[model samples]
Target chain A: MINAPSPTQSPSTTVPGRLETRGASRSAATLAFAWRTALRIKYVPEQLVDVVAVPLVFTVMFTYLLGGALAGSPSSYLHSLLPGTLVMTLVLLTTFTGTGLRSDLSSGVHDRFQSLPVWRPAPLVGALVGDLGRYLLASSIVFGLGLAMGFRPDGGVGGALAALGLVLVFAHALSWVWIVVGISVRNVSAVNAINIGVQLPLTMASNVFVDPATMPGWLRPIIENNPISFVVTATRGLMHGEAQLSEVLWVLAIAGALLVVFVPLSLYKYRTHRS
Target chain B: MTHPVIHSQGLKKRYGNHKALDGLNLEVPSGGVYALLGPNGAGKTTAVRVLSTLVPPDGGAAHVLGYDLVRDAHTVRSKIALTGQYASVDIDLTGQENLVLIGRLLGLGRAGARRRATEVLERFSLTDAAARQVRTYSGGMRRRLDLAASLIKPPQLLFLDEPTTGLDPRSRIELWTLVRQLVSDGTSVLLTTQYLDEADQLADRIGVLNSGRMVADGTADELKASVGGGSLQVRLLDHEQRDTAAQLLGSQLKAQPHLPPDPAVVEIPVIGSEAANDALTQLHHAGIDIISFSLGQPTLDEVFLSLTGHPTATEELA
Candidate 1:
């Protein structure tokens, strides 16, 4: 308060003098917004309800309900279903990124962030960074439950860790598609509905819950070509210690393609979106 | 005169053919409240958005705080702050965290941001609730936090887009007091409000907007004169004496007396305080007992009807 500039000097100087001689670095601003997201989760622990509960429910329900019929035994089904459900949980969590963003856009908070002098994309990028942590949480929950249910990986801890890394990269890239949806959509429910419409087909119709081999001929190609199925195949390979470089490269290409296309579209919509 | 803090020519913006801002021009001098008054959908928020560099104009040019709006937008953004219509503070974060976030973004160090946040929370009387999430705070508290965020660095120019739109009368007055203090410290402010009384009370000059263009602009009194003038309303003690009272008041005020459906009330436009005073005294002298009297400034509805030939919407603008 003591060093505050007097009123007479304001108009002449134009720019209001500040205590901080330099602006915050782009990384610092991004981290600051990430801190905001963390604080939000801390205050409203209920926001993490779906992250924790959904994964637990899916892991238990699928392993017990249809595991015996699908794989000829409940325990054996855990071997196949664990990796698939892990992909399903995290990849589906990416949809929430759009729903969160859509609400932020309408909350008037987005306008304030946009008006800031910091790096322009910091807020959106910061939110994406926070979503990475959420995906990590969901991954650990599914993996932790499977380990407790007598599910063991052939590749041991190293293979499981690699699988987790692949899921994160893929889920992180997929969030951009939802970020565009969040920014361009008019309301929150629309983002939610779109998430369900997109998620149901990808999670159910793909090779996540069962092998595409037993499917009718026409359905097999769709499941095999599905990107989620590619991610699942990549995940199963990593966890079982038999990962093919071509499969790894394919998953990388799909993730890279999503980042290349939707990242620009999301940022553009964020910058120019009309109220 | 010193260079105006804001000067723009033909500022145009269109939202899918709605023409939110259609070739509008504006100039606001530094160091006082300059209000933009208009009906809903009259481009008030759009103008604030464009000037604050949140949204780009489709055409036209603007200079804010002596920097070009489009070419030097980053410089302009550094010099200005905006408190949007919705209290833009993060509700899930505590008041302390919200202030710290804004301070850190504005370039303050960790310790410096915490210290500044403490001072700001105290100044805004939120120190007790600083640890609570903003969602727990009442509407007034949220708005105060929003304004506090805007003043984190004492920006050279502050844009307040309908700051007190939904606040109660007491809260509105409290916010007004805060704004007055900021102006006294010499922070130039450009505010928009749908209430004419708000503009009249706070603004040194006003621009009345209609359908994206500024239809009239000047001091409050000049605006009143442009729409004829303020009005004098008298509630009669006896409804039967209304005719005689109107005759006496008309002869004294020299304006046509407009008798509304209320038989006991007579309303007429008043140009000056002296004439209104004379009319009041004339009623007293004639022994026409008056139940109550009020000198009413022109409302936004009246202003719009006179300037644009239609009444403004009763709903919130901006």
Candidate 2:
């Protein structure tokens, strides 16, 4: 075993000065943590199977399985189905963020981060930022595969890009909901359970796969007014060159409101929550 | 007298109805290792957490590196690093990445962080595994990397909570050597351990904690001396003669012999070398055939048992 120190070694008792310029800024360090988290998908490719394979499988299955019944033909349905599937797939991927955060919290990594001198919110903020990549990846896969399966947007490239931007912004804001759940929940499995409970109902109840006009009179209002419905409607409007300023604004307003409430709520829980 | 590197008085914390830490006081002078030896659930980890600013204490006051733990927590955080009982480095990141991340968080610039990562990796003999993910590392390598991560800036003080809890003997010794080097270079370490030998081997001063209180604090020798000096242990060849041996030694040494769970062994405390010799001579003069007799200094185990009336939880489990 290691023993006493040798006499030749000098005891350097000088304390270094406070590092004024040496440390990275809070935002920069947080981004670095986020980047590292996203980069971990490279080592564990199974993480990507959800973003890559799920969107393709769901879009193909739903587009073919329900296309004739929901619309006149598969080609006509693709126009609406592709945009709706994009929103649904991106929303589903947000749950992984909660599961990842819960895992980190339970594994004692949070304790290490808590004891560090860095700003307390960096880990949570960085995690949200890192998950942006997953959201983007899922979006591209759904869109790219839609193009391959003979679906074309009436909206030009710019309109399609705009729609993608809106969905991403909405998904980004919606992530705070999961982030809050991630921090407050007891475990990863619990976070997954709660997120699925919230996500599945929102996706199914919205106008994702079918037009609300064909639904029962009582269900039309709930489906048409669902937040997911607003996003899917706005995205379809933009992608079909039928964009409306009010629908886009409504989506933005909801995204902004989710951000306003849940960001602070998640931050508050991040600061106070302990295991 | 120089101010202690760490000082706490009447520190208190409770979890619901159970007291995790109860009016505990501690002092550790600068430039050496101070080992807090206690059993599981004795509040050693709680004390470390409170001092390291991971958890706030419900009552009392503490100063670490001359800064108040609560009010001046930022200053204390800047001056200290903690390696928790678990290897807290990111498993997904490479060992080098873990160090660089900590370095950058500690305010080392990008280039500076890289340089420090390289240097600490070399110091811990982890250069070979620096590029590998920590998830692939053995327990010892991960621990070394964990310690290395905490040293990114070499704080004035470090908190090592059970640094060698599950390490193999060689790795344990290597960590001890590294700690000794760190202490020699003027770093103050507040280490908590259930292993008595670890404290005896590293601590310049040892503090015995039981039920969230410091029951004794002194150098190893002083604590041993307080427990009535060294002991003479005699083992009889025949189990039938054990009672006769205990009685004979009890009378010869004028002290009650302590019988551990084993029946063939008798342990008597002796004042000095002469008394030890007297006991051995008296045993030899008797008709009992001795299988073995040895004069030895009281180990911290005995000191711990004498002070607490029971072995540490780890020892009990062992």
Candidate 3:
């Protein structure tokens, strides 16, 4: 069948000026990249695994291991654990942005993108948006599981929802750093190795497992100041209805600072790199 | 002369210590096909990439469709489309979806994008496979889909980098026919290829690139002229006649004459069709009875060999 222009359609606009044409094409490229990235999520949904498993493991482990030690009872500890799982899920799911970007680069997909008339920001923005779906899917599961485990946020519904929102922004902001890693490096396995290898030190150095004040001198400085520790701690505080504006600001500050630094670097490398 | 659609002056690209495009210059008119023929690593793909705004050149200036190479990249990109050596379609998407996505990306409305997608698919004879995932489609099918995607916006300039590299002979011919028809409709195409016959059949002008430089370029006839124009081959009924013919033609034609092992054949090289005709007239006047006489034009392969002093390498379609 010969598919022709629809009856309702008039002539396509041919805008004057070279700059206008370029801008229009770039916009089109951005939309195409976004659609392609979104469709890819359907086939390879590895982010789901990270989002669900990480939060579930952390929730179960923390409630069982530290519940009696910290809260005097597993039931009491469970009441305040929902916020930690929610934040952790978002963080875990967001890290896949790097992995996915690296995979695309290694698999000839990036080369394909390079050949197009795409805007410089399209791939970066598309990848970020695509990973947002992962964050949402995983965060909701953590929330549902938290509810099933008897963990109720002392914060009202608005506070609880606001906490979720904070996690999403934090995750997206952190995604920029990994996008740099993905774009610069060609090996996905190396990305995974580096990410997984560094994560333990980072997690242990934070306030995830124990109270920061209880640590020794040198370790206490690093652990207390760690970003993830602040996120988890602030989230825990938010769930208890004790909103810490300072801590939330700290998370936002870190996210914003990373975006300021890494986004430009990624774009610069993207524009200059030889294919 | 009318202003060329593409003009390059001493374009150069380097990879660390290695130069990929070395002091290259080219000019193509507003329409028809211009094929860049080269061996492996000769920089055909690099040239295309640089012109398409996908790869930056280390030196030299190029104006593509009247837009500056570096300053007017966005403008150049808007007017041009590239179908790379490999199909650039998203394999996860269906064939139709890939084209529609490109159409929409090119600023078509949702309904318009869908219509354009269907139009291109039907044009490429891909309507039957429109709904199938590209990953499941055959290589030739994906190649056609990729070409269709590039044409969705009806770009004035198209860069087809080795368009039929991995295709079956039949599919290759089909694509060639389509490409020819596109050129006929006023689209200018720059096709880079290693397939000599592909250049011979498709290009209005063929530029033979070697070692990051254009060693020779012109219409197919001009390329052939570089290798002594044309020749005449005769096969006699006996070996003595072949020897006598070679001897007679050698002194008269001012050209090389050779006798094969079969001994019944003789070949005479000439500068052009006129010289070939002159040789035939001289041979008949000399009472040399020839069983057969055939004129031969040098192939692109021979022209490449003559220009580069080596066998033509494949175009490294990176």
Candidate 4:
């Protein structure tokens, strides 16, 4: 539909310079529109609830149950055990994105937003970015629960904080993959079934619950190099007074590599769907 | 003259092999209501979606408010608001909150958005129920809130796709009044509906679409007249005299006998009211008695039946 805007209809000048003019080549109006959409997530507290409680449950359950089973004593296991449980909790919480995305699409909110003036990428980016607070909250509670169970990091405050940061980045990276699955499958039940199928094999196969060395030699390398296992091992090492520069790089590398593949694939699917 | 507010050339949309909109072309002039009338599966909604910038056309060119549909889609969206068949209000938010949220999303400041929301709520007669959650609202209130959300920024063009679809009779009349009020204020409106009465009540011009094509486009009177202006009918007294009267009236007044199955009497139909009066004099001169007589305009339902081979109930909308 193209007709030139009437001379008297220049509403752009009505916005103040600070809101209308911006650093990015894109119009500031576009940016503020995206920000408003993101801020609307404040009313959606249900999405954040799962993120908060899952980590606390996992940390407490594992510290008491798996800790006594794997290590000689529950307290002794807390030293080496709390780090892996935290990583597992982060991965478990990524399913929220898959379920949330599917619910939004099926409930017709996605179609409703399609008619709005907001950018196509705005909703997708907002949902992912909004979960950043959830990820942070989950990570903090797991660490706090671990500390309450008498688990102390051998690394200083900076090293422990860096290790927690690594887990968060990895979780955020994997979230893109879940976002793709959510958009593709587009059903909450289907997402839950598929995620459980993948998660069971991946978590049990990694070093989240036990030492990779305890496994047979052939399977050891896969577990040692399993990205989840690598993050878990590095985090455990850092918390117990053993820190290494190479381990940090490995965790960051896994996050960066997943970002390289899944983010573009998800965006490509998103752009194509037209929903 | 200024370009039409909406213009489309060869608009085509396909969902897999099923063609939702097959080469639809429409031009709506600025101001007044333009109604898209079609039975279900006629691609009316698809056409609205393409024009409103909600769905991309597979092949075509459209311009809305001087903005190209494809390349200048963002500009087109900024100038237009679409309220689809279903009420898209968020059940979790209050009616006022939904309108205010949409205003802010359109880049209105907090104070301005709230003020606009209040104004639109009052304009739509929803001021009393503004604080209630949308889920608690009646069907009519929810639909009114949906329309108010679309009007927060005073969009130059509005797309109302079946705005009266599920409303009860009273609610439908209320919405019809609101639609008239909006068009009178210089806002151009494009409305799509299967209900002929809605179009008759609200549209300045009507376009009838069937099987993904516009079969006829004209003012309501023009379309009605195209199918024959009016009808005249007369009933007779006795079943025994039905055949006798049919032959006499057919020869005397040149009207068809549309007799219904009944033991008592018969009826005849003619194209004009004068024909009935002519039949009365002719029948009396021929020693026949008349029971009743009537003159009336052809309804849109009759117009639809004349144009399409079948009725609309079996057909579905896109």
Among all candidates shown, the one with the greatest DockQ: 1
Candidate 1 segments whose C-alpha is farther than 4 A from its true place: A1-22, B229-232, B236-264, B270-301, B310-318
Interface RMSD of each: 6.0, 5.4, 7.0, 9.2
Q: For each candidate, report its DockQ versus the true two-chain complex.
A: 0.43, 0.34, 0.18, 0.16
Q: Which has the greatest lDDT?
A: 1
What does candidate 3's lDDT look like per residue over A1-275, in tens digits? 11234431112212222212332255556656666767776755664664467658877888888889877887687666667667656765555777777766654446545545557567778767767776776777787887787777778787777777777888888788787777777677777776677754575466665677877888888888788887877777776779779988888888889889988887887677664
lDDT at B135, model 1:
93
Local distance difference test scores for all models: 0.83, 0.82, 0.75, 0.73
lDDT of 1 by residue, A129-172 (tens): 88887777677778888989989999899999999899999999
Among residues 3 or more apart in sequence or in different chains, the pairs in candidate 2 whose N, CA or C atoms overlap within 3 Å are A2-B177, A22-B107, A23-B107
Q: State the TM-score of the second chain for every model.
A: 0.84, 0.92, 0.82, 0.84
RMSD of 3: 6.5
Q: Which ten contiguous residues of candidate 3 chain B have the minimum total lDDT?
A: B309-318
Clashing pairs in 1: none
lDDT of 2 by residue, A153-178 (tens): 89989888999999989988988898
True contacts reproduced, candidate 1: 0.53
Candidate 4 lDDT score at position B203? 93
DockQ of 1: 0.43
Candidate 2 has an fnat equal to 0.38
Q: Over the stretch A1-275, how does candidate 4's per-residue lDDT look in tens digits?
A: 21124321111111222222111212333443344334444555655555446546655677688778878878887777677777877787777777767766664556555666766666566666656666666677777887778877777687677777778888889889888888898589898887678864686678877787888999999888777888888887766657577887888898899999999998888766634
The number of the candidate with the highest TM-score is 1
- Better candidate by lDDT, 2 or 4: 2
Task: Give the better candidate number (2 or 4) by DockQ.
Answer: 2
